[model samples]
Target: MLKANLALLFIILPFTWMISGQFLFSNGDKILVIITVIALITTLFKYGFTPFKKNIINNQYIYLLIILSCISVIYNYFHKSDIINIRSVLCVILYFIFIPLNIISTRVITYSTLIGSIGAISFAFWQKNILHLDRAVWQLNAIPYAACCLILMTAAIILCIIYKDKKEILTISILSAVISFYAIILTETRGVLIAVFSIFLCLFVYVFTTKISVKIKITFITILITIGALGIYTTQNRLIHDTVQGFSQYKQGDDLSNTASRLAMWKAALLLIPQQPISGFGDNFEPAIENLYHENKISSQLYNLHLLHFHNQFIDTTVKHGIIGLVLLLLFVFFPFYILKKTEYSKENKFAIFLLTFGIIISGLTDVPLEHKQVFTLYIVFIYLFLKKTHSVK
Candidate 1:
């Protein structure tokens, strides 16, 4: 009973804090920092720092890579001017806290996480519609939250197909998917839409091509067709309008316009690349990028908005951390896919892992999912758990 409760708390706390942090806390809130500290303490107490254990260590290369990354972070913190970015610091610390806690796996964690995610999605929908909050339209502050939830829901669906579980679990998975998709639609985030669509397309193709039973295949095909039709009707008119508006704004070439501002920001980020090509400017690159925009008189209106990071994740990482950072980031992003490929698991498990890994990689391309503490914490915890599970099977 104690173990079950602890497992439930482990899953609930991280996910709950992640979803609620955006709605309840302001940027750089001490509450978030305090929560991180508490999580770190709990993880240490529960997991007991058994880093030398073979299962926890996993691979020597991973240990070296993580150690080096931590070293880089420490070096940046002490030497770099913008090391005081408390949010970034806390995000890194959370990753450290989560990795060990995830060393021990439990079905309680999985079920609790799924339940919590559903509740969060419901809350997000309520916030958007009943409360009529504009910010809630994006659901969470970051598009990646929606993306992560969608990935998990997709995994749950695959589990339902594979396992001979309770009918209620399967129903819950379907409901979670529906809720996640609804939230994603309201975000109006093109990147997330594209990623979700890509995953659906892949799943459709896989189901159609595979040797699954005719009845199952037909059901999947029917669902796919319905989803596709709905997606097209919903996105066509509004997406076209938004694309045209953005393009027109770009053609007008006004620095203050949204389209032109992003272009200018991209240019400013590029300009910083040559100065610190190897490691860029670390966390301070944002202010420097803004200054470059100001100096060029590219987009004073946008620059004056106190924009801290580039809206684009790839550009942001390249400018801030340089090539080394990019490599480490790539490894973190791609490692899951590599592990999935190695797993000789059941088709359902493989499909689920593939979709989850692909969704994360595609989402990371456009948004800095790793920079947000809530998203980062959830992501690291998931990766750690999934990797541990795979290794245990091996």
Candidate 2:
């Protein structure tokens, strides 16, 4: 009975983020989170925490990162720089526990991820066709929703290549990729588009350079690029026109575009970083900006927006959590690369995980993917899932 409950928890964890927001997520995410956490704790008690060896050091960096996160949470709590929510902080800190608690194999991840992708993609179709919604957010935050679509697209592509022998599955995977790519374009999420397209471009180059037959390679490249070109043409205004406009506006010194606004935010955040270089102004964004405004440090443009993060993940963390937070965040992100580099794995698996992680990192340059709960959970889930199976807790 205990084992069965644990298995169920493993299966449901991924979809918590994939289907979040009003349409399908709502209170459903909270319920899933509750059950998963409970199951994790119960299993830990029953198993006596045998996942780890006696004080052995393997993934110490992960522990350090968690400790730093907890410290920041506590520091913000007593100091009251901006605002502090102990409940949420505890949840973030305890996320590490899930790594050790989940004992399921790679197959569990495979099934759960596929189910989550299908549900999310299905939800996207419902929003677009049934509701006739204009942007097709799947009731998710627009930017993050687009990010999810891109991730699903890449996952489908990976499945298509890996399961090439399975004709039915390959066909379904191709269809899924098409739907995801279409949804990504419809949303007009520029940052995620850049990230996803870059990965595909890399893959395109790889296939061309490989030993594959000239005929097959040419056919594959032609089809993929043709569909991608269609998406580009449809999204020309947001993808091309606005970007060109942003550069022009920036040069004219009367910057008013969204890209210009984000660049301004990054500058403003960086300026404030030196003021509280060590500990930071706490996690409350408004209070920090308020202080900047009082001192005439922030411009009226940035002051009005009252952003939580500077649109860039690194600078965002640095402004609120200080240098320590910035370094820890970087380490946490790059640490996975270290594991992936050393691990013995299939090329497809390595490339798939790299696509996911690299896309998130690139997307973070324009958006704080780690700060948002959904994206944050997405990062944590993929990192641990991609960890080597031999990275034993015992």
Q: Point to the candidate with the largest TM-score.
A: 2
Tens-digit per-residue lDDT, 1-394, candidate 1: 9975775465345434543343223352355556656655665566655532433344532453356456566857754733123453454444344545333334434454566456556656677778877752444573655655655555555545544245655566566566667666655556667677888888788888888789989997898778857875787654456656766776676546444566666777778877888777876665675567768745666567566666576777778777766776677666666766675455655666566667766776656666665555455545544444332210
List residue ranges in candidate 1 displaced over 4 A: 1-54, 57-65, 78-110, 136-144, 161-168, 235-238, 255-260, 294-297, 338-350, 388-394
What value does the lDDT take at residue 90 in candidate 1?
50
TM-scores of the candidates are: 0.76, 0.77
For model 2, the run of ten residues with the poorest summed lDDT: 81-90
Model 1 Cα displacement at 94 (Å)?
A: 9.4
- Write the residue-wise lDDT of candidate 2 on 103-199 in tens digits: 4443444444455566666766777778888663446676776676666677667766666666756676777677778767766788988887787
Worst 10 residues of 1 by lDDT: 385-394
Best model per lDDT: 2
Instruction: Tell me the lDDT of candidate 1.
Output: 0.59
